[model samples]
Target: MSRYGPRPFFPGLAAALLAASVTAAPAVVTDPTAVTVALAAPVAAGMAPNCATPPALARSVSAVPWPQQRYAPERLHPLATGAGVTVAVVDSGVDRRHPQLAGRVLGGTDLLDPGGDGTRDCVGHGTGVASIIAAVPHDGSGLRGLAPAARILPVRVSEQQVVDGQGTGRTVAPDDFARAIRWAVDNNADVVNLSVVLYADHTAVRDAVGYALARDVVVVAAVGNLHGNGDPRPYPAAYEGVLGVGAIGADGVRADFSQVGSYVDLVAPGSDVLMAAPGQGHHRAEGTSYATPFVAATAALLREYHPELSAEEVAGRLKSTADPAPGNGYGAGVLNPYRAITETTGGAVARSAPVIALADDRPDPALVAQQNRRADARQRAVLLATVGGVVVVGIVLVALVVPRGARRRWRPADPN
Candidate 1:
């Protein structure tokens, strides 16, 4: 997905970011007594440095048993499984036969061809992306989505793709994408995930996205993956009221190529992150493209919990409570499922005391300097003490020689 990244400006949040890296971090609490914030900046330890084409999936690992996988949809399973919510995915296409996503999908439209074949996974990318939103762990193998009960409305725009010199792959046309968006809205999808990015200047695409928003459908679009200057003018993301998401890595750092700007709304795990693929396999992909589904999944969960919530409300909950990252550029930081499901995200209100965590994303130059200065002072004090002790010893040695005769006279007079 190649679009634009939102670099939201919040001077007040900087303090919270500073506080997050320090001692005894609390659960994303806004108000607490004396949370120790490390004045030092955070290191982008595990983040992908720049936008690179997301690599193909690693050789399939033995499928993880259903009970022991990280992507197991435990917290969300009991609530609703997004049973009543339908999410539309505008991308390559999905493989309904994939074990993890079996039987959960609802009907969808295909814009790539005249035939009705939205379930085909020509690129395997759509299957992977859709499964990540609603995959069921089959027979204790493969990955499950956060909201597996939710249904996928897969809309394909391309047969396959070839990644050009730029980070994005080319296959889908912009006109097809616009048509897909309208189809999603017409089909009553509560959330629409756009995982494809193509270059086109058309108002119809914006109108499609806006149409979904007016109907209270969440239009989640990836902020594209062009890392440096290859970024085109803002597309569906820049359109008002659409939720634009960026791609970050497992390190909780922003991907270098996921476009960054004032329009970006949030980010999630996108780099080397594993999800279901076509042909009974699993793999990792990069870019804001892959990350948008995670947000859509969260929206599905929210709609499941509170069917009364509008798209704006669901979006607010996601962004407000999202996990705070120091350098994460948006109103919300990283998209965290555990927090989002429980309504524990710190973005709920303007924090009074500031949330403190040990996982800050910036470097604290002042803190480093203080530590160095303290060490230097301690060394100087120790040196002075050692010198004073040595001088006292030398005086005692010299006095011992002179004092004997004088001491004898003074002592004898006293005795007499």
Candidate 2:
């Protein structure tokens, strides 16, 4: 299939493809080409996946801590652990009964299936994302989130289906997604986390995000992971005034599959992240979907610590304090949550930057070129290494299959 081809209607295919290509290197293309190609794809919504599996219970062990290198929650816990802040996770439903999220999740609505409450999650995606934001550690079995003391408001915008005992996955209509964001804003959510990607930019969604911004609500979204195909500017993330987040691995570099663009406000740990799954267990997931909550949780802490800062100011602080890196894709840089919370603002006022209505948030030309060059070089190196390893393995296999005498005869000719 082409990079921007129509997504498979069968949710299983989408999920399987996502899992298989979690680490695939993205193809570098000019902004215009990427945007045009991505626009050709059908407008549908689905969860971005690094990798996922069925929720199953695992044995409890001693306090198994999250990788501090990825997210050092302990460092900031002393100052502010998102106290008095409410983060709205807009995605599939969350498992309220999950051990990690039991007391933290507040009442929310299910826009997808109005008959059911938003407390139960059919697929574990929402729960996993929520856990990354506010899962409370209990008895050392559960993992602690970036803002453990923060409250979670689970707003279910998508519905998951189970066919033949396997999760078929979920989808959210643009209207529903828009409604969910508006609802979160109306409910006084301090931060809104959108983990899903919509192929098209719907007016409703954009307006909803604007409304949230007007109310000083910090909106964080995952820049879509399309296996490096096409432009990664998926909605809500593509919308102006929203903090678009990308994924970086433990190496502190952008993930090969992470979408790169100017809209990427910041990046956080996304690969092999251990989070709470649906059935009271934990799972390691990857994708920009997982990266978003770290930023959202950080926003909660920022809002809690500096209630005086506006949403724009909080976003500016994050950008201003981010670690500088090579590309426009990395945005300001990787997130420094501690610096964002503790550093003095120096009395700088937040400025209203121009909000581009276009889908591709146009990045600086020089920076884009540089980022593309670096990405291309890295991908080439990885490709060469893979090829070399394969060739060596093939040679070994051939040698093993050949007789001893044949192997000796096949030795390289001696050149004097």
Candidate 3:
């Protein structure tokens, strides 16, 4: 009865139903690019004025006990505190006036609103992420970042919509997302932290990531929080060559809300993560978005210690040195900053790899084309295989059932 062919009642009907179910997976919903701010709970008010002197801020943070003992960056700080490394935070702007981030933030562009200040964090999400990566705790406050000495370059790509002290919606256009990444690479960012996620895979975004990798710029992204939906690969986290980071708790177990996927490359403490919030106070936040900066800051440390290592090599070192844990969601394992900083690689430098280029960076058109062709071919092959399988199964079922149906129709009624 179907347009494709006549329907069979026995085996053919079963085969058709099987094929339909096989292809009935839920349609992928492509949500707009947005900042991943999970839970922001104001724990305590550290100081009267948030913009205190470095010494005062340190004193305030030192009074807190959890952040210092949790990740324990002090063990590796003596070796390298991410000196001379520039980390670009591409998210909802950063609070340049935050006491912990004073004098560390560099000039960055605001792609969402041109001519606007990128350092002014209205949503507070970006500031939290930045503080966790490079906030100086030397003055004594408990709010110490992974790489205290590293410089932060704040690139604002998403506009945060805050309602009742919580970020309700943070959205960025695909083009703006791509532009912010390219801008970071062009500005010589040593490590770029993307604490936002786009549900759809935009080519412009992928190209920008490729461009960063080619220029030896380390790109780290959050693997996204599960928004009630099943795990979906988030971009630029899911993009090739990006270092995707998932969230773990203080107990070293994966956070329940952290999205699991093959693209996840590292895990860090995200639950009850104490960091600087806007208005000079400290907040305990949760999400993979918070976990990503830890990895980015660690990348900055590795870059500082091993300046000779390529971007890929820096990523490899992080993966190789991670504390081994089980699960595709956990990637190689939980981030081991101590081992990452101190471990020696037998004094061998990584081999030189081809660099991807931006528009102004002498891009190779032929190489880009070849890579695209390969990706296209692979996609086409998958499609062909799926369709071929359905057709083959249908034909076999028809062959088996046609003769049996004929026998049943031709059989004499007297036999009954």
The residue-by-residue lDDT of candidate 3 on 92-169, one tens digit each, is 677767778888888888875678557855545677788889888645467788898899998876543322333333
lDDT by residue (1-416, candidate 2, tens digit) is 10111111112222211111122333343442122111111111222232243334444334544444445777888988998899998866777777778788999988766765567665566777888888886775637888988999988765443333222444555666678887887776888988766555667777788777766678898886664566545666777788888877777778676787767878877776777766566666567878888889888998788766667788888877777765657887888888888887523334457443324355534334535755776799899999999999999987776777585776657896
Return the lDDT, model 3, position 62. 45
RMSD to native, candidate 3: 23.8
Whole-structure CA lDDT of model 2: 0.66
lDDT of each: 0.59, 0.66, 0.67
RMSD of each: 22.6, 22.5, 23.8
How many pairs of residues collide in each model? 25, 0, 9
Query: Judged by lDDT relative to the true structure, which candidate is superior, 1 or 3?
Result: 3
Candidate 3 displacement at residue 371 in angstroms = 24
- Specify the highest-lDDT model's number: 3
Kindly give the stretch of ten consecutive residues in candidate 2 with the minimal lDDT sum.
1-10
Question: TM-score of each candidate?
Answer: 0.64, 0.70, 0.70
Flag regions of model 2 displaced more than 4 Å: 1-54, 58-67, 161-170, 326-328, 346-416
Q: Once model 1 is optimally superposed onto the true structure by TM-score, how far is the C-alpha of residue 218 displaced, in angstroms?
A: 0.8
Model 3 clashing residue pairs (backbone): 58-139, 58-140, 58-141, 61-141, 61-142, 62-140, 62-141, 62-142, 214-356
Report the error of model 1 at residue 228, Å: 2.1
